[model samples]
Target: MSKGKRTVIVTGANCGLGFESTKYLLSDKIDEWHVVLACRDESKGKQAIQQIVEIDQEYASRLTFIELDLADLDSVRNFVTNFNQEKLPPLKALICNAATQAPPNISTTKQGYDIVFGVNHLGHFLLTNLLIPHFAKNDEINSIVNVTSDTHDPKNGTPVPVPTYGPVDKLIIPPQETPKRDSRYATSKLCNILFTYELKNRLDKSDEFKNHFRVNCFNPGFMPETSLARYLDPKLFNMIVEGEGKKYRKPIANSSRYLADLVNPQLDKVSNGVYYDGNEIIPSSDESYEVSKQLELWEGSKNLIKTETDFIL
Candidate 1:
């Protein structure tokens, strides 16, 4: 690894928005940076690399793969441990782009937690916490981008409908009453923003890492063809967009491009813990920014991962 070239790890890079973001980030015009296209399947990772090479040869070498399966905590632990054990240079960017919608049933992880809660929230939460120390190693503007969704809206002040994440030990509505089809997914995405705010506060207050990293979250809007859309009932994704998201629903490519720009932009002034969809830092509902609630969510995440990993708090 070149000491001067920054490295970024983007999860779920095999297809859809993740794939598009990888393509945009590796364009020939971009700077010489290393992008670890973290994926569950190594073969697909190679395919992605090949596709990028067709775009530009130099971009091929800049992209590499690190196998990761968010549903498995052991996989998460092993990936981080291997990376840390190698004592590689400090990390530059960690993008949490992998996610899932409500499982067909109440699926459980290897650790027996709900699947969406496991992959969409806890998995990235643990990964980011484990890599915090690496960020503190340099002062060259480290970033952690959490890709959230726009569905978690504010009804008056409270996020009207929330999912049941037992691990987080907080519920806005009972699990049975909660709209499992779509609202469940929205709740997890809301958890992403809350996680970002809590983690940003940790970075800002830490004497050891205060000046090293910037934590922010964003929504890519409602993209119809992404892998996450596969979780919805047939035609449901498009139907919902037509009903409530007609104005904000965007093309997958455009969403990916906007996310790429957000990840590595030329802007000089940006706020931490803000959620950006494209160019706009859209305001989250009041509940999403509840400072105390954010802290509680952070602690819950840490405790969940602590049992399986050796990451420092």
Candidate 2:
């Protein structure tokens, strides 16, 4: 790895938005950046790197892959340990882009938390906290971009109705009774916003982090072409995408461009805790802005991480 090059970590980077964002980051001044593809599958990660190298030979040496399974807290901890051992350049940005949608049936993660919530919110939350020290060491402008969705807002009223976010206990665990699969997915996305809001608040309040760090969330809008809908019934998923989902659906590249812009070091200024729809900064759901809910999620996340991963934030 280059000693002085800026470094970034993109989770779920093997395909879709993550892949496109990685390509954009490496498209110019290739040698000036080192990108770590944090993927759960080694084979797919290697394939992604190979494809990028073939297209952008100038930056082939700057790309690397590291295993990261967000479904398991132990795996997240291991990823951090392994990344620290590499001793690469100071961390510049962390893009929490990985997410999962469950089938009609309720599923649990390896640690027994709801699978969607576990991977989408809690996993990324822990990962960001663990890496803050590394980001703090760098004086350059640093950022954390959480890839959220417009569906987090109940007002979207597309694909399916989004459920209202509840207390932390319900948010983290599978309900005693199974909820509609789409509701679970929507709840997880809402948690993403709440987490990002709380994180930015904490960072702003901190003397060490207020000026050095910026945390924001992005809604990629709807991208029906991606594998994100793989868990849905094939016929139904196709029907929705071809019909109602078609109008709002954006090309994966468009979503990536929006994400890439957020993390671009060239950008002059970025506001903390802002939510973006494509390139525009917009207000999120009113519920997402509730300080009470944000703090509840924050405290609950800390407790979960401490108990599940034996790591204190």
C-alpha root-mean-square deviation, each candidate: 3.6, 2.3
Query: Model 1: number of clashes?
Result: 0
Pairs in clash, predicted candidate 1: none
Per-residue alpha-carbon lDDT of candidate 1 for residues 1-313, written as tens digits (9 for 90 to 100): 2422667779998887788888877762544456777788889988988888787676755777788888888898788876666443346788899887666655666887667677888889888877777653643677788998776664422222443333375432224422444455667887898888888877787887786676788878766666776655666556666676566668877777777766563434656678886668878767787777777777777776666445555
Candidate 2 — worst ten consecutive residues by lDDT sum? 304-313
User: Best-fitting candidate, measured by lDDT?
Assistant: 2
Instruction: Name the regions of candidate 1 deviating beyond 4 angstroms.
Output: 1-4, 28-30, 84-90, 155-167, 170-182, 241-243, 308-311
Candidate 2 lDDT by residue in tens digits, 1-313:
3433778899999998898899987864633667899999999999999999899676677888999999888899899999999877778889999998874464777788888889898899888888887773555788899999988887777776685676767867776655545587788888999989888878877887777877899989788767788777789888988898877788788789778778766676666789998888999998899999899888888888776444323
Model number with the top TM-score: 2
**How high is the lDDT of residue 204 in model 1?**
84
* TM per candidate: 0.86, 0.93
Where is the poorest 10-residue window by lDDT in model 1?
Answer: 156-165
